[model samples]
Target: MKLSINQLRALEAVVRTGSFSAAAKELGISQPSVSNHLLALEKHYCAQLIHRNGRLAEPTELCSEVLSRIRSVLAMTREVEQILEGRKQLQTGTIRLGYSTYQFALPVISKFMEQYPDVNIEARAMASHDLMPLLQDGNFDVAFISAKSPPPEVNAFEMRIEQMVAVVGKEHPLAQFEMLQWKQLADLPLIQREKSSETRRVFEANAIKAGISLKTVLALGSWGSIVTSVQSGMGVGIAMAGEVTELDNLVAIPIDDNELTVSHFLICLPEMQHIASIQAIFDIASQ
Candidate 1:
């Protein structure tokens, strides 16, 4: 008997989402249909591929071993479909894009949209660390991530190099400095992004190496919130140089550390890079 694509997709979605109903929603199918597909797959192989524990669905050892290959298969299937679609001159399609920051991606997206107006984009904003995993899970066709090094599995195009800077209210004393050291921030109450933020991760790691202990008085979820808190004098905030706008009350001072730099990259699974729409994004980004 031939293995069914729907069955494989059902298993993959269930394991990725961790629940039958969630997988059903992701696949845009009914819950019973998802269950039936998984049941059919398991019966055909004579193996229990998933272990249902309460609401969570955990893949069995056998399933775990095959999941990566299944993902590759699915990715390749999409690639083939895109290849066939490309013969149509890339008139219409959707690009699932995940971005950590809009500062860089917005411009490229703007250019791509101007050229391919018929193409629809589904953009999701997430933290840098969170974006990569979702991109790898095939949730996003492409992503903009901030990191010191690109992951080995994807093809990355350098978008921009950004430096970490200290943002302060104009009344703050640190605002007068053109450049500040890690130790200069040690005594200040800091406003930062969540723990999962790559900016925070980079800043904290550099501070530790500089032997400085810093205090974070607030952990905000978004750059806008951090900027607002800093402008209101809640605390000093860390941000990328580009993230700081020309707001009257806020000042962005350079951090005098070489390692305080982050490279923003536009990345996609290597297999999907040749797709016409995906290739167009890369081209736009390079310019």
Candidate 2:
């Protein structure tokens, strides 16, 4: 059976937009044209691809499988465009990256920028959970995540490992110590990153394992806010050693327990990993 790219794109738009009309609007065609495309695809495959429920078309199992392949095709199509652009000029193109906890990936991006001055770079810093959906939507080409394991859909390369440290205000008594035990945190009110952050998850998991429950005084969404709160003497905060900066009023002390090193992973959709810009960034990271 033969299928056209238009048919696959129409099906993908229908599923992604949840209706033929929306797909038509996205494709700049009429609804009937979108329907015809799907009809032709179903005829070629000899299987129903969608089940209409009022205004929405839900994918059948066959369509579900086809959608996955279509995404791969679309991604490859984008990669082909990138390849063509690169052939025109190897020194120019854009690399869109998403990252959680900026400090872990900053040095590599800096070096990458220095090496490829003409390449355009866009970076977004967000919670690990928030970045994945953006990555799936193709808003980002790659993401740097702090997690023990990346989701199964992506190819993940371990970039760095950092042990969690206790950050306290310089005025706080704990500031004098070069190292502190996890159990010592039992008495300090904690300033933690929001629940969606991987740093918070890793710290909380190890905190439980060590039989310590944090007395959280504030839960801030951004790392900067958490650090500011710590500086204000609101409470102690947990952070990776590399993540803490602007230390004029704060200090990071190593935790005596060694089980809390958060692994930083560079993640991208497996299909897009071979793109030149990503490979260049990955090479810099591997160094």
Candidate 3:
């Protein structure tokens, strides 16, 4: 008969416990069953694998080689079991997703939720920097982060490759213009997101080049809030172009003669790819 898993385990038990009776007892089988398994292994290998003198059984030269081979097979089996266990953990698991802004995350989360009905994903909004600790502590499965401060611990993949836009109140004189410069924006009241956001980071950097600071008439918590406030004659909110879907009530003016790109990333542990559910989500998003 061909060698089998039971045969391998029986061999391992025999080698570890040093006797057929002990191995059989450990495996909850009879001593005769253990001897039968060892004989089957020896027959499969076409080599004598045991030595017996009355009540004692010892490993022969070929038996030592057989033990080594059995150990290798057992090691591979254990690795496969561990891999399968990991996949099971992923299929019915929890994902703690940390996000910087809802403007980027809401749609991604909506799509992911629909795709992975089994994987329960929880989302928490925090500053990009604040989310790092949760990811480091293993509290988070992944993070949608940007203006990413490179940490040696987390793995990041750019997901949403997007560009920034300049919004203007419909009545604002700037709405009449096709393109404008940073100096031109300084003359108008600019609505800014909270200081920690990637959008503001680029805005401030650009303002510095123009020898101007972001002259904010308002600082808001969310991009939608800023957009709505801007529509009500508050001020122009700087945001991504794709986010302005309902602009019938407002105007999204592209930055004048300049382009600003903001890309959001999907971050996770490097080994998360081995997880089937996580890999499934990643694959769907990638497509």
Candidate number that wins on lDDT, 1 or 3: 1
The TM-scores of all predictions, comma-separated, are 0.86, 0.85, 0.63
Tell me how far the alpha carbon of residue 145 in candidate 3 is from the true structure, in angstroms, after superposition. Answer: 2.0
Best by TM-score: 1
Candidate 2 residue-wise lDDT, 70-158, digit = tens: 77686566556766876753376788898887777789899999998878899988888888988876578899998877789998889
lDDT per residue as tens, model 3, 1-287:
66798888887777666688888999999999999988988887787766766656777887675564565465446545645765743344555688886767777777877866656778888767677766654456677776624456556667776667788777988788776676777756778777777777876776677687566888776666787788788777787676677644666767653536667777776645444555655665566
Model 2 scores worst on lDDT over the 10 consecutive residues at: 82-91
Quickly count the clashes in candidate 2.
0
Q: How close is candidate 1 to the true structure, as a TM-score?
A: 0.86
Pairs that collide in candidate 3 are 179-256, 180-256
lDDT of 2 at 94: 82
Model 2, which residues run further than 4 Å from truth? 21-31, 89-94, 110-122, 133-139, 246-249
Candidate 1 — what's its lDDT? 0.87
Better of 2 and 3 by TM-score: 2
Cα lDDT tens digits, model 1, 235-286, are 8988889887775358999988988998899999886786777898999999
Give all candidates' CA lDDT scores: 0.87, 0.83, 0.70
Please identify model 3 stretches exceeding 4 Å from their true place: 1-91, 148-153, 257-259
Clashing pairs in 2: none
